[model samples]
Target: MSELSPYEIAFLSGGPTRVAQTALLALYESDRIRVSRGTHRVEVLPREPEDLHPVQAAVIDQVPGTGRLLGAVLEAVAAAPEVRAVADALVSGGLLRAGLRGALRPTGEGKALRRGFETSPGEGDVLRLAALGPEGVQDAKMREILSTDDPKPVKMPKKPKGGHRDLDSSGLSDTQYSAGL
Candidate 1:
């Protein structure tokens, strides 16, 4: 296989969300976007570079003119079609397994690619690696952004298995129940 691009490496490493984050970080590193340290607000700059990766452009599109919270922007861009296209390409290229909904398993080639990249990362791999997690990031602010910007969905606590005792059909548990009135 030909040498894979950093974006592709990111997809292999952590799927579409990583691709979105790589694009976002690339935009920030390139000065295409501005991030507010105080509020974690992300805004696209007026100056548009003629050449931008599809995911990068999509990330910019995800942001509003008034800017948006960093976490929300990351979530929006991760779900964008452009990011999905990267996954599709990987699947078609025999990297990622097809038909997996929740957790995408990588094919042999994908695993080897990830392993190779991890073992001997090139200079270009820095941003993509950083996008995977905060460990690879050097800048304190960027690391903070990487570590805190993406918010995971909260898992709601499960309801009690037997249902509420207060609403039991026997009526003994009911508030108005009078045992021997």
Candidate 2:
């Protein structure tokens, strides 16, 4: 499998311009990798493995949840300024295409560049919540799950035995009942 250089990886990760610049600088310093910036695409030659920078790792970590928006990726990376710079750099390098909503999405080349940063959730990572029945109904199963050994007594309002009615008729208008006086 062909590997991606640090610069390529940074550009693909998608962040502010400054962050991409820093990543590119780091990649340039390393001899194992080569970079090609063009209007059509940014290509990385002779990709090599290197320790991931903290910023890159953060962005990668957050990508799964916030891949839809550049701003979301910035929030994940917690680098506001860097996110903007990286976004500009990626667009300039042809690593990403600008969308109608001012968001950046990975191009074909960009996907290949981010292979090393992929991650998956591990086993036993269950999300626990109160199980609800259909339409938020408190079904028997839900009730069983929620019921405790010492359940609190539910206080129900007492209803009038003879139904609601005014005991005193002092304010009654003759026209109200239309009864013969």
Candidate 3:
């Protein structure tokens, strides 16, 4: 990061309304760039600047999912009502350019937005399943393990052996048994 002046820092930190003033401060801070603030303003700084505009870089970095809504970008950066003011300042300063669907893109900004979804507790299950792949073999195994019960057989009470003696005796006679032999 380049060395920031107190005025520049104050201007940048003074909410989104002071974005134009912040840009001017940033331009003044840059050794390779000069700016003039007035009607028919003309000022020549140096060329081939080594550093880029910080505010524009930050705005670009906040943009996500390609061609994002202006309001959404503002909310993402927590800039709220000041977003339009800051955006207008950046546009006028030529530090930012509007892209498709009114999305802001930084000029000469490198690797603006960090691409990825935030990891939250709510997404744990989704991330786990995604990591496991679409086959769901791990899920099946987990379900099987969870559904298993104790491996024990049920026991029944024993009945008296003589309980059916009368019925058995009625079905046969002593003469029939002797003839069978």
Candidate 4:
């Protein structure tokens, strides 16, 4: 099999989430996208490259004008039709199989590609390390995204118990009702 692209390697190593995360890392590194620290919001910059992969483009499109949360962007991209197309293509090419727990199992060719990538990764493959599931990633930016960049949790107000006021507080009692018709 021919050498696989970083996207292919990322999918083989992990799954759609990894693909999305790797694509985001690439875009971030290339200045195609901007990730807000602390809040983890993502926004597509103007003058985006025209040669982006479908998955990368999808990620950009997924972000709204106001920007989206990092975790939301990752989830959106992972489930996007473009990313699914990549998985479908790989499966059609006999390089991947659907394994237990929705995991992607690589075929022989896929295995060889992964072996090659792990053995001698190409330049700028450091961003792809996040696709490998947080291990072997040394880049500060990549590690920051993987470790600290997540959507901030919404702070919901606590609900009152029993959902009603006390019956004793009412002026009337159950026994006080008239039974006469």
Candidate 5:
């Protein structure tokens, strides 16, 4: 298989939330971008002959005041500058396309990506491993298997027979899923 581009990795790893979750990580994955981390904030530093997508670079350029770091930006609301910029970048950069006229009009690319993230095993390995964080992997073997920036192949520890995903919280079956939708 061919290698994943940084943008592709970010989209498959999660989505807008995943990109937002580690803005710096996602941004810095591209050779054109660098991150300057302060005690409480970060700056999105761009390199000359920028290798980033036009949309991504443009959004980074518009991020105000050295970009307010990763943590704060991730926790910020939709209207916040960074969140707004990232959302725009996601669509313009082709990770997600614009929806139709309505407020909830789903875009074609967005729907396909969402389905892959939720249902494609080949695509969801990193996502599931990410969900099962370091704390979730109590065993050294699992931890060793999961610790990597770009995992080429992964051998996930088999789920227990009873279907409890982890010990931290009660695992919910399909019927028990929240929101009662």
Candidate 6:
């Protein structure tokens, strides 16, 4: 198998959110997106015609909410509240492409990563992994497994048999007989 790129690795571990988060982090690291030391917002700049992956280019175009810190932006976009907007922005920006039957398809390295986090197991796993990265997922799984305590089934006691000596042309005994019953 071919070695996974950082984007691919990020995708396999989680999903589109992780992929976008990884892209943003990469862009920031490369100085394509700059964050001030004391500021929460990041600055997105237009590219200057250089060799770049489509995802990077997409993110460069879709500069998102400018209120939170650099790290907070990634986390929030990767998680609740802003995640939906971020995802829509990613799709529009071309960082994300819809797949067969509207599944999350890889644009570049995302295809090569070869992940089914959205399908295999279930969508819940994909969302879970997305919400809690790889380490967090493992920790949660371990906690779940460890939290469960199995116990042997207890056998129910059988009732005493043969209270009636005989039946009066009926299969039922005296205990079963009643007025018009």
Residue 129 C-alpha lDDT in model 4 = 68
For 31-60, candidate 3 gives per-residue lDDT tens digits of: 322322221121335356354545533434
Cα error, residue 108 of model 4, in Å, equals 3.6
lDDT of 5 by residue, 3-115 (tens): 43333434444443443433333354453334332233345564666465533544465457555543344444223454445455555655555446522222566555555
Query: Residue by residue across 81-155, what tens digits does model 6's lDDT show?
Result: 334444465455444678899865546644433344333323333233343443333435322421233233344
Which runs of model 5 end up more than 4 angstroms from their true locations? 1-24, 31-40, 63-67, 71-102, 105-113, 121-181
- For model 3, give the RMSD to the true fold: 31.3
Per-residue lDDT over 26-68 for candidate 2, one digit per residue giving the tens place of the 0 to 100 score: 3333442222221111123344555765544444444342122
Candidates by TM-score, descending order: 1, 4, 6, 5, 2, 3
lDDT of 1 by residue, 26-75 (tens): 88888889987767889999894678888888988889899988888878
TM-score of each: 0.74, 0.27, 0.22, 0.73, 0.34, 0.37
Q: Which predicted model would earn the best lDDT? A: 4
Candidate 5 TM-score over all chains jointly = 0.34
lDDT of each: 0.74, 0.39, 0.35, 0.75, 0.42, 0.49
Better of 3 and 5 by TM-score: 5
Q: Highest TM-score, which number?
A: 1
**In candidate 3, what residue range of length 10 has the lowest lDDT sum?**
113-122
Question: Clashing residue pairs in candidate 2, if any?
Answer: 15-83, 16-82, 16-83, 16-84, 16-85, 16-86, 17-84, 17-85, 17-86, 18-85
Measured with C-alpha atoms, the lDDT of residue 123 in candidate 3 is 30
